[model samples]
Target: MTVSIWQADGTQPVREVDFLVVGAGIAGCASALFASQAGRDVVVTDARDIALGASGRNAGFMITGLADYYHKGIEQFGHAAARELWALSIKTHDYWRAWAREAGGVHMDQRGSMLLAESLEEAKELELAARALNADGIEAIYHAADPLKRGYFAAVEQPWDGSVQPVELAQAVLRLSGAEFIANNEAYKVEQISAELVAVHTRKVIFHARYVMLCTNAYSFTLHPYFRGMVIPQRAQVMVTEPLPDSVIPVCGYSDYGYMYYRMTHDNRLLIGGGRHKFFEQEADTTDDRVTDGVQGYLDGYMRRFFPEVNARVDRRWAGTMGFSADGVPLVGTLPDSPRIGFAVGFTGHGLAFAAGTAERAVDHLLYGTHPGALWAGRLTR
Candidate 1:
């Protein structure tokens, strides 16, 4: 995102904005909505159009919490933090569901979701996770044996989790936010000039904004050096089978220790994604959204292994880049040096689970100096 020495040469127009949001993805749009609700005139700008990044390319499973099993999350991040994060995820889902009801046409199916186990050890983990969830008063069904009879060992089902048309939902959020959107606008530099104004230098214009929120996620490294090691971009590959006569699976299924996921689309197509873990070096730390044969081959094997009955042809193959935090959680905070430049990034492939609540907390933090609780970026330093 470098500007050439000769291109435009200080000719870019300077626009004064109230609350300028960089990145029009789901997080950015949600931030805009909350900012607008706070009576700030918000403008959202993106490197690409709205929802064209991982927000659009994801499998659209609305499963809650971090991308780890509940028990594992508690073990990794302690019990209190895990419960807070799970509650935040539910809050995010509540916002999306309310917005969907308001939009009137957004496609959202509350068919619930399942965390199936591909191995015996994972099945044991699933049992623990289900027990932990139940002990915490979270309603979840634990299956000791394969519930789908698809050769899986066990499952943890969340009856409140669901699936969605991600792009449509993002667009609906943008429309509801009523923020002015600028597409194909790449913000190269953001600096707090003086103590009151933040300057955002983009390809189209220079915005002197009162506040700025970077929802860039996977692209966060491109804008600031602080995110270079904090947010690693990993590529995600996906392929959807041609429509079948009927639904193959009634719920969104995540298995193989969260490395692979499959769901039945509204049109009756089987969509499967993941396998980058099989080729870590090739898949990690890059923003290249290109499907690789290595990962796609793994997905092919996965489909055949779990869904041997499907004989449909592959309809399309695509890729996306997910931002993985160094700590396996979303980050929400302002730059310490430039506190006016706030951010909500590093969803770790759980944007739907974390983004809405994170964005709300981010906007409130940036606007009112409130703290972002468990998701505080300062935790990475501590």
Candidate 2:
């Protein structure tokens, strides 16, 4: 079933524009804002509402670089290409610092992140990876967290990482006065009207535009058949605890890399998420965000095992769906030289950290006909 947090106001697109972007997630909102600023008439819409999918439902961690370490990225791509990707990811992160401020301070924290491992061998690999990332200018260090001495793992602390409320950040960006946001409306089809015009079909209306950008992330399967083999949907589970007493649990940081992450909210509630890969086949759809006993049981065990100091009950449980790509990187670019078809999707669950910058660059390519930062564009062009 589709999930909605914002009701659509009575606004329908009855006229033509320069651009129409589908999917109001981070990338869509970013594209809408940039395209509008570029003097292109722009309209942004989503299937349900803004920030309703992975945007609102993620755990909100912002660790630097891709899901893999520097060495792994090098292994996948060549050394020079990997280095450039690393530098660009870091640059995008720095750009995020300024973008957040422009979007009215989007709740970015610098509380750091810890990478834990269960075995000594895994710890050695992490240490080696940390060294390589450090050499590549990433500030990751091998430090065994005190929490892990109690059996979490030998860990590495990346000082530049932190968390945020992703949906709120996307909403703040959408508040830009120049962009038109259409909520509760889904894009049913895209038909080219002419060389300079295209039509975006919703359930009720067909909106016309000169350009169409697909920033729908995992939901792009309906529009792009290639995404089926490139990007696979993965569901992540999360739980938030009731606000504990101030001194009871000094809620400060976050843990886990691609799985098993938790952070303390401003209200003093502990929000934790992970454990979808544990039940791989069952989590590939955009269905119920409700938690299951198997996943919840693991989360409960994680709490008891790592955070035994604060024996708090789970106030609420929920799940969020994220797209995991085959090569573990986002795909952002035009649909093979089609002037009217631009797309930014397949984030593989870590798009929140760099989505705005990625979308901005993608829209720049759409507007200028070529991207200045060819490295970022090429990295995501897959």
lDDT of 2 by residue, 161-230 (tens): 7777787778877777257877877776676667777777675457878888888877776665655656
Model 1 worst lDDT window (10 residues): 1-10
Query: lDDT of candidate 1 vs native?
Result: 0.92
Tell how far residue 177 is off in model 2, in angstroms: 6.0
Best by TM-score: 1
Tell me the lDDT of model 2 at 368: 75
Candidate 1 local lDDT, 149-247, one digit each (tens): 999999999999998999999999999999999998788888999688999998889999999999999999889998988898988999999999988
> In lDDT terms, how accurate is model 2?
0.70
Off by over 4 Å in 2: 1-14, 144-148, 247-257, 285-288, 371-382
For this target, which candidate reaches the highest lDDT against the unseen true structure? 1
